[model samples]
Target: MVNKPQKTKLSSVISLSHSESTRIFEKKSDLEVWSAFDKGDEMAFNYIYRGFTPIMFSFGIQITNNVDLVKDCIQNIFIDLRRKRGALSEVISIKSYLLKILQRELFRSIKKESIHSIQNIELPESAFLIEVSHETKVIQLESETEINTQLKMALNQLTARQRQAIVLLYEEGMSYREIAEVLEFNEVKSARKLVYRAIESLKQILKN
Candidate 1:
């Protein structure tokens, strides 16, 4: 198993990313960064990697069972981006674009292996990782254990795609268009519909 980074350090990294992610991701700023990145800007490249690497790891292990493979894929994605930056297409959301890369890379890795065994072995752990924050629940145990359980239970009731859509829509604050692009859907409206259906399913799961 590839070592998952400690939550404390990941939290600090994400905290730092909040401002940098915001600044570089503003509407005009995104174009500026991409323009600079395309022209072989090392600072721009480092900024993108530092800002995204942590969450990308968390997201990747869900898509593929092999943590090591996920780690390698992450590096490969960035390396390819750096090498081909000049020919890259303009994108609306860099986060979404990066997510698309992660998903595609994971899919490629999965296809080359014996997927059935890996999927069966890893699905439960990966699903839980995505659904419940271990650190969040620890402090909340005294006050809100039931709420936490309810969320995990509700998330468990979802299909994997539904769970992914819900997380992207609510937690990541991605718009439908961005989600459509990341998920490779033909239309943005489909992404919105999927999220709505996931929300309704969660409500039904919690009710019952």
Candidate 2:
């Protein structure tokens, strides 16, 4: 039998030319892009996904130490964008709008975790093995321990719902609208009030 060379697939090697790449960004204003996206413009949505995913990823990492959780939060936010597309409207800025969505999603995830966190067992001692000088170590340990103690005191100062709202909005970066949706509050104002009251309580707690 004669030997024959195997053909490799070339389809995957296709790439965007420089002009094509430039055209994508130069094509539309933010409002126009999102308005089209609202009506099911897949291209617009794809552009939005590409532009905002990294920002969301950064915010997620800052709030949650778990990379997997960050990935899951971002994926869920994009899924939400698709799911809510029909109701989207012209906004002041696409970047801000996308960030708000990401913020809301991350907060929702954090609130859920906080609710379930009590069930978590203590981590092994090996998790705290980083080294420093004895004085620095003592200061670091005392700082973290004091923060936890103060946080608990602050939590006790607020009503349960207020505490949850504060944690989700301030700690987790969720917006008032998202907090309303998650908590079944009547409006964003209500969510804002919940957080506001909680902050006041926390200030009082810290002062004492």
lDDT scores for all predictions?
0.70, 0.57
Q: RMSD for all candidates, in order, please.
A: 7.4, 11.5
Model 1: colliding residue pairs:
none
Clashes of each: 0, 0
Per-residue lDDT tens digits for candidate 1, residues 10-111, read 334334544555565444566677777788765566567777888788777777668888888887777667658789888667788888888887776675
lDDT of 2 at 6: 12
Clashing pairs in 2: none
Which candidate leads the pack in lDDT? 1
Off by over 4 Å in 2: 1-22, 25-27, 115-208
Model 2 poorest ten-residue lDDT run? 5-14
